[model samples]
Target: MTKPSNFIWYELMTPDPDGAARFYGAVVGWTIPATRDPAAGDMDYRMIGRSDGGNAGGVLALNADMIAGGARPVWLGYLEVADVDAAVAAIAADGGAVQMPAFDLPVGRIAMVTDPQGAPFYIMAPVPPEGGGESDAFSVTEPQRVRWNELATSAPDAAIAFYKKHFGWGQDGEMPMGELGAYRFIQRGDVGLGAVMPLMDGYPAPVWSYYIGVYDIDRAHAAVRANGGTVTNEPMEIPGGEFAMNAIDPQGAPVGFVGPRTS
Candidate 1:
């Protein structure tokens, strides 16, 4: 399995890019620097960053007209893959479906896809062994380190199988969530790449959720609200002594962050 060092970027493809940018700028203390592709109808790209020049990620205009044809506003994870085409083929053979065929990017090739149960994610053939450009200084703004990403799915087992085939991910023992049975962890090496769990009782269909790194739960929570986001789950302790909170950005994308327990 390829070792995923850290999530390089988080992107929001939303209906209102300008509003989303303003919302996140308030919530994450980031500056939305403008970038656009004139060829794609002068598509706009806003790079999320702090005043100090750390880029957290980006936001793109979802192109409502395109959605009329069939695209949805969603948070997509871009995991680095060694070979984009090979990963695409492997994903299909393993029950996942490709939404956007592998396409070239300035840095590398990427593709949007869904797991067997429909959790969406993107894949990129990393331009460099260690992802290039810049590191997100946002981590320093929060108390916890962006630790683990968890994807709750209706078909957790199939999700596991699909990633195992494509990204060479292997599972660790499960962390039971009461009546929900067990939630499995996926890893490439010592680092926890992410997790796959059953979807909560009544939420939208399956989709990948990111866990940002934070050092203080309370501070992060305050910042989130101050920036116009909502704390869906207040800061709380998990079984293993980690503190976490679930949040929704002003644009309504599900996001989470974690830090070691303060106590």
Candidate 2:
């Protein structure tokens, strides 16, 4: 099983890549670089980064048919598995389902997969010559890029089982979430990979939400709303003293940025 601690790349797939790019650029303090994708019908792959020429991450408009076929606009986290084939096989044998088979790309072999209860994510084995390391985007802010991720799944047991069998992520602790009984936090060490919890009261099920690191939560939240995204949850301070704000991109994907609050 792959350790969830190995996650390095994050990607967002939406129908309106340009709009998504614009919204994130302002919220996360990244500049969208112009780079064309030959396979994407001439639509440029919008690259995000700091002004210092750091390579942040990517956003692409999914093919129209993918969206029409019941794919919801959402943020997807990609983990670097040691072996893509083994990971996909283990996912099926354990309980999860593979939405897309492992396919070769310039980076590596990747597959779209969902947990047993249908929370979607991607797994990949990076191509060797290119090697693997942290994204340059981390250079923009002191602790930039992704620092944490959480999946509020409807099926906690099945979600935990699937992830444990697939990624070797262990349960950290569980806390009561109002009427939802308990929400479980999973981790790959000290870093959070995501969580398995009941959907928030009145919230829809089976969506993966990513929490990105920023230098300032208040500024990030304000930028998100100013750039046309909606804030789902207002900025709040955690017991640890850090602050977070959850928002939705123009494509309606759940995203949030976190940073230390001023005293």
Candidate 3:
């Protein structure tokens, strides 16, 4: 049986690696180091460590070739599966495209792919350590960790069905959004992962916006402004009464934070 994916890891590909580190360090309290991953050979790949220890994900510096090829600052997530090659084949047969071919890594096999809607993400069959537990990259309330994964797609129904067929995700319930569309919530078994919202004028293309947990929503907003980032909107109340806001980093990567709003 293919183990249903739980977002295993997250990665940020940016042009300004140092600037991204500093910006996220201030806003999300991540302790990103200056060292690059030796396993990546010559590529500048740095692990994004959480303040409490362990990694939130990684940051990859965009090379000249990549930038020239139209790669932009974006955050991509890794979804774990039982067999990478099998998953890739299944995805391709279902109208998905392979952005990067599957390859073996110290962590496991990973492949970059786009959904039928063109939103890109990674699929991995992670090789866990001898006794390492499930990934801590996603958490609901832990500060500095990925708290929510929201996907804004042009075709919400098709996108939702595509994900459900490949990843074993289930659409549990939805919240009506007036004239726009309903915000559909998806869960992996009992764990409430996040929601899928319809793309609007503000978001023309399909993209996944990950919201990291913060100690205070207002403080996080201030940090973004102080670090040359732009907040898209004021902190708004979520379903749980917590405030959530979105922003674009210095390099124009959309990011989000969720927590209480302390004035």
Candidate 4:
């Protein structure tokens, strides 16, 4: 529904939603409202906001029950597909695993799925709101939104092939990462969705990491350390003259930031 295999939304599941809201508010410059609507049926969920007042994503509070059921603190992105049941069937047949069965919500039907290499993400068949429009949750050149989605997996070639078949993603130009294999860029239509690269040794595991756009990299980096987040990779100049970095949030979830080096 969303342009065939586009990333529609992102969610951060953490033990401390309030603390995460505060940390991300300072770093990514998002305006997270303190009070959640009491009518969401006791779900501790908060919608993330961009500086332009658009919906960025959502934050879900992970409880003990979810933790015991194998849920951990992680930032997961939602990939929009056309058919939830058909996609789930294809994923299961192609070595991918389904974490959550397709379920209906106020927004759409969604299911949690993992790639063949064990990196987890979501698949959704969205039902557009009253006013029909595309989601602005992911933007390559926008601040305070998801700028990139990168996957680090043990099997890049296999993962690339599998995603291509199900999601219609194609491989674009790639960058050499030496022994870690190429940073194989993935594209959907004219937009560069993200890249698939060989997983590094020190990483927690094979995972999909998203980079959030910020106005200043230095200020965002400083806020990460100041707000109890640990920097796994320091801010460095990336392609296109912007800088990016990786860090573990206070609740131990990994996140990345991409932006200009202002002051």
Ranking by lDDT: 3, 4, 2, 1
Q: Residue 116 of candidate 4: its Cα lDDT?
A: 85
Candidate 2: residue 263 lDDT (0-100) = 39
* Model 1 C-alpha RMSD to native: 3.7
Compose the digit string of candidate 4's lDDT tens values, residues 1-263: 34548889999998888899899998988876776646456778888988788989998888899999988899999998889999999999899999999998878999998988889999998988678988889998999889999999999999999888888888989999787779999998889988999989887678999999999999999999999999999998888999989999999899999999967
lDDT of 3 by residue, 39-119 (tens): 988889999988677899999999899999989999999999898899999999998899999999888999999999989
Best by TM-score: 3
Q: How much does candidate 1 score in TM-score?
A: 0.82
In candidate 2, list every pair of residues with a backbone clash: none
- Per-candidate TM vs. native? 0.82, 0.86, 0.97, 0.96
How far residue 180's Cα lies from its native spot in candidate 4, in Å, is: 1.5
Q: Residue-wise lDDT of candidate 1 within 83-128, one digit each (tens)? A: 8898888888777899899988665798988878888878777566
By TM-score rank, best first, the candidates go 3, 4, 2, 1
Which residue ranges in model 4 land beyond 4 Å of their true spot? 1-3
Candidate with the larger lDDT of 2 and 4? 4
Give the range where candidate 4 is weakest over 10 consecutive residues by summed lDDT: 32-41
Stretches of candidate 2 off by over 4 Å are: 2-5, 37-44, 129-143
Q: What is candidate 2's lDDT per residue for 103-150, written digit by digit as tens?
A: 887667899998777778888887764464544432223444766677
Runs of candidate 1 with Cα error greater than 4 angstroms are: 1-7, 34-41, 50-54, 129-146, 239-242, 260-263
